[model samples]
Target: MLRVADIFGRFPQLETEQLILRKMRKDDARDLYEYASDPDVSRHTLWNAHRSLLDSQRFLEAVIEQYKSKEVTNWGIEHKADRKFIGTCGFVYWNPDHRRAEIGYALSKSYWNQGIMSEAAHAVMQFGFKKMLLNRLEARCNVENIGSERVMQKIGMTYEGTIREQLLIRGKFEDVKLYSILRSEVSLEC
Candidate 1:
C-alpha cells in the first residue's frame, strides 16, 4: 500500500545557491525526455533509453508513485540562473541497517561539464547526513565513467574500490568503481 503522505515525506525540496532540487511532477514529462530518453545519458546507467514519450510518462508516474510510497527520494534538478529543468538526481536505495545509501544521478548532455552534478551532490549529502541521519553515502560509477568519478571527487568522497564484473547491465557484466563519503569525513561547509 502507498500513501501520498509517505511519498511526500520521502523527498524534501532542497535549495543550493545555484539550483533547486525538488520532487518530480506529472508535467515534467518534457523535462524527463531531455535526459531519460537520451542514449548518451542512459548508456552507462543500468536502464536503457526510454522508448517513447508514453514510456517516460509511465516511468514518471511510477516514480511519482514511489515518491508517495517512500520507496525512493527522486529530485528534479533546476538551475536557478536559467530557471530551467536540466535533469534528475537523488538518493536511490536507502539501507538503514548499513547506515548508508546509494546515490544516483543523470544530467542532460547540455548540463555536463558545468559542475551541476557536484553542486547537487553536496546538497543531497547534507540531506543524508543531517536530516536522514545517515552515516555513509556511496556512488558507484561504471569503470569508464570518469566524469561521474570526478563528481564524487568534487564532492569530497573517497574512492573505495572497483568491484570487478559486479553489475549485469544490458546483459554484460560491467566493472564498477565505488566511492564513499562518510558523515565523519564531511566538511561542515558541505
Candidate 2:
C-alpha cells in the first residue's frame, strides 16, 4: 500500500553513469529555460514552449510546492559532466490501489539520440516497480513522437496500441501510443 507520503516524504535521488536524478532547485531555472524554451523540445510535449525565464521559474515554484505536498512530481535530470539540468523523468500518475503508475519524461534536444533518456527512464521504472511496488508501469507518447516511443521500447515496455484522440495537447486532440511493462517482465536488478 503505497501512499504519496510514504514515497515522497523525501524526494529520492537517483543516479546513472552520466546523469543525476534529483529534486530540482531554484538555480535550475536557467537550465530549464534553456531547453524548455526550445520549440523542438516542447513540440511533442503537452506543455507549450516557455516564453521566458519567468515561465521556468514559475514551473519550478509549482514543482517545489508539489514536493512539499507530496504530490506527483518529476526528478530533474542533471548531466554529470556538464552539471546542467537537461531534463526530467518520473511518475506522472500513480494508482496505489492497483499498484500501477504512468511515467513521463522530456529531454533537451541537444541530449537527444544519445541514450541519455533511456538510462534515466530505466531508473525511474525500476523505482516504480521496486520502491513503489507497482505491478504495472506504463508510458504514453504522441503517435508521431518516434524518440519517445524508442525510449519506451528501450526500457522494455510493450506497445499496447494507439488510442484515438487520447490526449488534448496544444489545443488539439492527439492520438497516443500506450506502452506498459509488468513487474514480472522486468529483472528488478541493477
Candidate 3:
C-alpha cells in the first residue's frame, strides 16, 4: 500500500546530467512566468496564456497545496548549467490500487530541441516506477503537439490511441493523443 503521507515525509529530489527535478518553490514564479505566460507555450494546451505574475503566483500557491498533502508529485526542472528554472514535469494523477499514474510536463520555448524535457521526464518516470511502484505511466497531449509527443517517445512511452475532441482548449474542442509505458517496459538507459 502506497501512503501519500510517506511519500511527502521524505521529499524526493531527482537529478539528471543537466537538469534537476525538485519541488516548485515560491521563488520559481518568475522563471515559471517567463515561459508559462508565453502564447506559444499555452497554444495547444487547455489553459490560456497567463496575463501576469499574479497568475503564476496563484498557480504556484495551488501547487504548494498539493505538495503539502503529497497528493501529487510536481517537479520544477532546473538547468544546472545556467541555474535557470526552465519548466516542470510530474505525476498529474495516480491510482494506487491499479499502480498507474498520468505524467505531465511543459518546457520553455527557448529550451525546446535541447532534449531537456526528456531528461527531466525520464527521471520522473524512474521515480514513479521504482519509488512509487507504479505499474503504468501515461501521458496525454494535444494531437497537434508534435514536440510533446516526441518527448513522450524519448521516454519510451508508446502511442496508444487518440481521444477525439477531448479537450476544449482556447475556445474549440481539441483532439488528444495518448501514450503509455508499463513498468516492465521502462528503460532508464540513455
lDDT of 1 at 101: 83
Candidate 3 C-alpha error for residue 69, in Å: 1.7
Query: Model 1: per-residue lDDT, tens digit, 1-190?
Result: 3332443465689999889998778788877787788899998998889878888899789888887776666688988888777788888887666677879998988889989999998888887777666789999999989889999999999998999999999989999999999989987654
lDDT order of candidates, best first? 2, 3, 1
Q: After superposition, how far is residue 79 of candidate 2 from its true place, in Å?
A: 0.5
Superposition error at 147 for model 2 (Å): 0.1
Name the 10 consecutive residues with the lowest summed lDDT in model 3: 3-12
**For model 1, which pairs clash?**
7-67, 7-68
**Whole-model Cα lDDT per candidate?**
0.84, 0.95, 0.88
Q: Candidates' TM-scores? A: 0.91, 0.98, 0.95
Which candidate leads the pack in lDDT? 2
lDDT of 2 by residue, 46-86 (tens): 89999999999999999999999988789999999998999
Least accurate 10 contiguous residues by lDDT in model 2: 1-10
Better of 2 and 3 by TM-score: 2
TM-score of 1: 0.91
Comparing 1 and 2 on lDDT, the stronger one:
2
Off by over 4 Å in 1: 1-10
